[model samples]
Target: MVTVKMLKPYYIKADDNYVRVILAYQYFAVFINNKVYQFVPIESKEIRINRRTKKVENLGARFAFQKGKDIIYMAMSELISLPDFLVQLHSIADPYYLNKEIKSEPNYESEAIIDELEQLNMKRLIDKALDNRDYEAFQSLVKLL
Candidate 1:
């Protein structure tokens, strides 16, 4: 039976020899398990209805990235608290060219290429995101396309 679980957001320091999986929004390093998997965003739109008020309201988007055949789905919102090194690398800082510096670092180039190819079909990906009610993802696709 396939097991599902949430992966706490973790960062692998520069000295670590783990595989880094880069995505459009964020990146992660799988240190313990050298596993092949894909993360599928679960719902993009989260609607909540008050029982007493009987009114439906849009809650901030709730999403989880379902991982691999094991089917673990980690909530993206829960990961929001984690620092995004990629973003931070590109952002203004004393080491103004940190982004460029990190480019030379060890990245799973093959996996990165695979991710790019998977996302090559912008229209199809956008359609899927739309179907999931993920407007943010849809907008990102628009910019990418």
Candidate 2:
């Protein structure tokens, strides 16, 4: 049996100046200021040998969203994770209100992840946090709920 994974919808936000995309625990890309950084899904390749004919076949995956493109592969021996990268982005946009709008919107990855979890009936966690007067947690949860 083939195992099927349920893909969360790609989180996207757009303004006249920028397009921000987050693929949840995977990667995020922000397109703005005439530059774009993308962290996208990638797959590994393997070589299979047919016993009967001794023929070798290379098998790999093409990303569902990035079809028909020449892919250049690169690896960083040491690198920051997506969450950290997002934090860096927020830091750079500081004093510019990129973290949230005036009313504390759910404008970041952590909030987006919480929103996804809440869709799975995890509201009680938020309620408990609110009950305990965890204002920070409450603020994060209240946006998407």
Candidate 3:
């Protein structure tokens, strides 16, 4: 049986001779050395693997790949990463008024928008963040929660 390892380093040699690294909860596997080498974190929308110089590249979401026996899968790099409290906080944005002249430049009524939105509208913001691999955003939202 093919053991489905959770949250561990997984290396697979594609038929094209490239190694792909499977990351936990990530959509695409990292490719390198004409073979997938290692997979990055789930929120890394795009991770570049350079065989010649060992460089990292970024590609926001828009990912695609094939699994064993020719099963294709797709997912975005951006996805909500906020914790419980932050998620709840971000959901209620319309109720309050965001002032742009008070503190920061793009001052929102409340950064809580991100956290609460992700939690309530789980389908929209949360999914979007993961698809784009925006874990940093998720982290910020989490703190607020």
Off by over 4 Å in 2: 1-53, 56-118
What CA RMSD would candidate 2 show? 23.5
What do the candidate models score in CA lDDT, each in turn?
A: 0.41, 0.40, 0.37
Candidate 1 residue lDDT tens string, 43-120: 542222332332223335444443344644434343333345223322312222123233455669888997888777
Regions more than 4 Å wrong, model 1? 1-37, 45-60, 85-145
lDDT of 3 at 106: 65
Sort order, TM-score high to low? 1, 2, 3
Off by over 4 Å in 3: 1-7, 14-19, 25-47, 62-145
The better-scoring model by lDDT among 2 and 3 is 2
On TM-score, who's better, 1 or 3? 1
lDDT of 3 by residue, 59-96 (tens): 24433333433433233323122143123222322123
